[model samples]
Each structure stands twice: as structure tokens, then as C-alpha cells.
Target: MPFLKTAKLSAIAVAVVLSGCSFKEDRNDIVVPIIDAQPAQSSKLQFPQETQQKTKTVPTYSYTVRSGDTLGIIAQKYLGSSQRYTEILALNELKSSDAIYVGQKLQLPTKGLKQPDELQSSNSNKKSSDIEPNKTYPELNELVDSQQYNQAIQWILNQPELSNNVELQEQLVELALTQSKIYKRQQQVADAETLLSGLISEAPLTQNNQKALISELSTLKAEQELITAKRFADQSKFDESYDILLVAWQQVGQPLENNILFTTTRNKVSEHYHQKALRHYRSQELESALVYWKKILAVNPNDDLALVYQDRVKALQNKLENL
Candidate 1:
């Protein structure tokens, strides 16, 4: 009986040792503490709003009916010139030019109008440094497309190229702007994934690498915004302005003081509105035409087309009233 008990105790010890050896260190189980946590969204990675409100406001007036206040004098004071007698007559609802009464109330009108224009500088040193880039970009594209990419690249990479070459400058400006934006975007993406880098304490030993993959994906999305902005600008140029503004529009956010693209585009668009106003007058849509004409006059009162339409409409309305 004593021998049997001793044998049984030995068997128990062997069973315990065997159980420990069979126990596997769960290699398949994963416990990722570093939360891959979804990538954060930023407003910068969004489409910038287009179509800002006009900054200029129409002039308001407060005039007094002083003694010996003649219409010609009123025109000169308010209109910046005394030759606008007609404007005063129209504003005051006077039937005759000679009719004048003492102590009468009159709100004067200015026959002349001036609107904001592109600001200019006469300083030569400042002027030389201000010019658009990408002037040669289009030409370079043309050359490259024609199987002369090496020559095109070489010309663009010139150390001291022509300053007056608008096309070449335009391309360089656009490329520079795009590259800068991309670099900034990449930096932001890297910042967003800064915490993920800590998870890879020792790289080669880990078999599962899902967290690394997620980080890379987030970076790629940030890059998409810049590409999207460029594509939209390109599309707008293709549709409305064409090659006239394609490069300039893309380089708009750059540090370009001398760039005429913004002013040129504004002028081109304003001219289009005036042209539409003229067409409406031709179609006899007088009231609708008048509204567009006013906008044109507000932008540029000196426009002959707007002036012609304005006079013709006034005559037609006067004739109708007489009948």
C-alpha cells in the first residue's frame, strides 16, 4: 500500500508538468492598445468658397437747399463737374431747364461716375520684380507634347531667363504653388499620424501591420484636396476663360503681387455682363436690359455700349408715354 501511494504522488507531479508544457502562448491572439483611431478631418482640406461680395458701396448724399443754388452749380459739387445739367433736371423731376423757384428742395445728381480700378505703382525698382509666372509653362507643354520634352524642360530650368515671358512665368508659378501646397499638406498628414509611429516600437518582430496601413491611407486623403483644387481651377479655365487664365488661376494663392490674372479675369467677366445687357436691349427686353445695364454702368460708366443702350431705352420709354 505504501508503494502504491508513492507511485500515485509521482504520477500527479508528471501530469502537472505535462499540462504546463502543452499550454501554448496564444500566438494568434492580438491586443492592439494603440488605438488606430480614425483620422481627424480639418477644414483646410476643403473647397474654398467662391464668389465673394463686392467691397465697394454706392455714394450717399446729404445736400442743403441754400440760396442761389443753381442746377449747374449742384452738378459741379455733387457730380464733380458743372457740365452735367441734364442729370440735375432728371433727378429733380423738372419739366423745363429754365424753371427755378426760391426756397425749393432739390436733391442733386452727378452726371459723372468713377469706379474702382486696378491699382498701379510708378516706382521702377518695385515694378521690375512684379510679374506673373507660368508664362512659359504653356509653351513648355506645347514643346513637350511635340516630342521635345528635354528642350522644354531645359528652357524652363534656365537660370536667368527672360523676364517678359508671361507664358513661361505662369507655368513656373503654378508648379511652384502646387509643390508648396503639396509639401504643406504632407506635413499636416504626418502630424496627424505622429501618434501611430509610436506603436511600431520594434518593426520586424510584429506579424500584423494594420495600423501602419491605416496611417498611410490617411496621408493619401490629405493629398487629394490639393489635386482637387487644381482640377477644379483647371476645369473653370477650360470652361470660361480657357488658356487666357488657366495657369494664372491655378497660381492664385501664391505670393504674386504683380499677377494680373485676378484683375484680368474680373475685367473679362464684367465685360461679359455689359455685352449681355446690350443683347437684352436689342431683344427689346427693356426693363430686364436696364438692370444689367446698371450693373455695367456701376462697374464702368464710360462704356459706350452701356451708354448707347441707356439712351435708346430712355427714348423708347418717353415715346411710349407720349402715345
Candidate 2:
């Protein structure tokens, strides 16, 4: 009985050891599933991070057009180049450079656009070695005072140091205006127009200054037309004179309206045409008379004399055709 009881105790101890081994193997299977689950979660988290790292965005800006704002001026202010005006034009889908109006909004590309502080810093850097250290404003004034206009202009334009000098720019504009007047006095109309136009484009002029320059240029062109028309009239080329004056009257009538010289020349040319028309009318050349009458009416739609004569010549032409 004692031996049987000892054997039974040994058998129970072996059974307990086998069950403990099976429990350890089940725990390992559960832990492996948990470890594999961690790798799937890590991959999902890393994918979003990789996608976020790959994405990027560019920036853009908007600008409002102010009075005296030009594409060239805007480009120069923002892009550091007046030549980039074409880019502005393209961005805005503008067919004409003159299409922008005051208060109009424009989209500006931020790429390469310089901030005001950056532009100033660049100017400061440029001033260090690019300009003549000894050149001064007083010396420039001396050139203008001596009436060395060409040299003064060259100095103002060629000096990069004067790029940000507003006072010097104002002086350059005034000097250009004075020189243009001298050219006009010398009967150099083309030269005067060219000088004013060049200053308008090249110099950083204020709105009022630019407007004044444009007005002067228009007046110069009108005066040149008057001179040319009178020359043609003196040669008895009434057709050429009439055509030239007509174009001037149509295109630059506002500027010519206040010009005494233009008005006087226009009146003289009109009278010449009227007299030639009268000769043609007296000779019964109705077609030729009508041609001159129509030219007068084209220039001055309110010309009572031209209106009556045109009516009479047309009536006579109809009468002759009917007979």
C-alpha cells in the first residue's frame, strides 16, 4: 500500500510539468501575433509622414495700380528689371502696355520679386564699388548751369549711384525739359520730341512730370505738322497740306486747340483749300470742288461753309447725271 501511494505521487508531478510546457508554447504564439501587428501600424504611420514630406507649395501676390504706375515701373520696382514688364503683361493677359488704369488690380508672381528692404539693401551694396567715389550732385549741377546739357544727361544716366537719388532724378527731368525747349526754339522739332520721349521712358519721373512731358511731346508733334503743312501749302500742294493737317487735327486736336500757331496755320491752310475749291467751282469742276469741300468738312465737321458748298456740289452732280 505504501509503494502504490509513492508511485501515484510521482505520476501526478510529471503531468503537472507537461501542462506547464504547453502553457509557455501558447504564450509565445500570442506574443508573435502582437509583434507582427506593431509592424503594420508603424508602416501606416510612416506612409502619411512620407507623403507630407513630398508635398510643397509656391506663393503668389497681388498689387494695385497707382497713379503713374507703368508696367516698366512696376517691374523695375518689384523684379529689379524694367525689361520684365513683358512678364507682367503676360500674367495679366494684356494686349497693350497702356491697358492698365489707376486703381486696377494686378497679380504679381512672387518668384524673384524683391521686397522694398531687399531692394534698398541691393542698392546699398551696388553703391559700394559700382559708382565713382568722387562724383557729387553739385558737380552735376555745375554741368547743367554751364548749359552742358548732353554731358549732364550722360552723367545722370550713366551713374548707377544716382539710381535711387530722387533729387537727382527730379533735376534730370527738369534739365531734360529745359533742353527740349531749347531744341524747340532751334526748330529741332524731331529732336525735341525724341528727347522728351527718351526722358519719359528712361527717367523715373513723377506722375505730374511725366504728364507734362507727354503734353509737351504732343504739342511738339502738332507744331511740326503745322510747319510741314504750311510748307506743302506754299508749294501749292493743297491735297498734301489738307491731308497732313487733317490727320493732326483728328489725332491731336486737344493739344492743337489751345495752340495759337497751330490754329493760325490750320486757318491759313483751310482758306487756301477754300480758295482752290472756289476756283474749281467757278470752272464748273463739281467733282474737284466736292473733293476739297469734303476735306474741309472732315477736319471741321461744324464748318457751315463746307456743309453748304458740299450740298450744292452734290445737287449739281445729280442734276448733270440726270440730264
Task: Kindly give the stretch of ten consecutive residues in candidate 2 with the minimal lDDT sum.
Answer: 27-36
- In model 2, where do residues sit more than 4 Å from their true spots? 1-140, 158-170, 187-194, 206-208, 254-261, 272-323
Give the Cα error of residue 127 in candidate 2, in Å: 36
Question: How does each model score on lDDT?
Answer: 0.41, 0.61
Task: Put down candidate 2 lDDT per residue, 71-110, tens digits, no spaces.
Answer: 6557667887654665665565543312345455566678
Best candidate, lDDT: 2
Candidate 2 lDDT (Cα, 0 to 1): 0.61
- List the pairs of residues colliding in candidate 2: none
Question: RMSD for each model, in Å, please?
Answer: 35.4, 38.2
Residue range 127-222, candidate 1, lDDT tens digits? 322333334356665654564433543465472553444445444333332333344456755533432342233222122343433333333343
Q: What TM-score would every model get versus the actual structure?
A: 0.24, 0.38
Task: Give the Å shift of residue 66 in candidate 1.
Answer: 39
Best by TM-score: 2
lDDT score, residue 289, model 1? Answer: 69
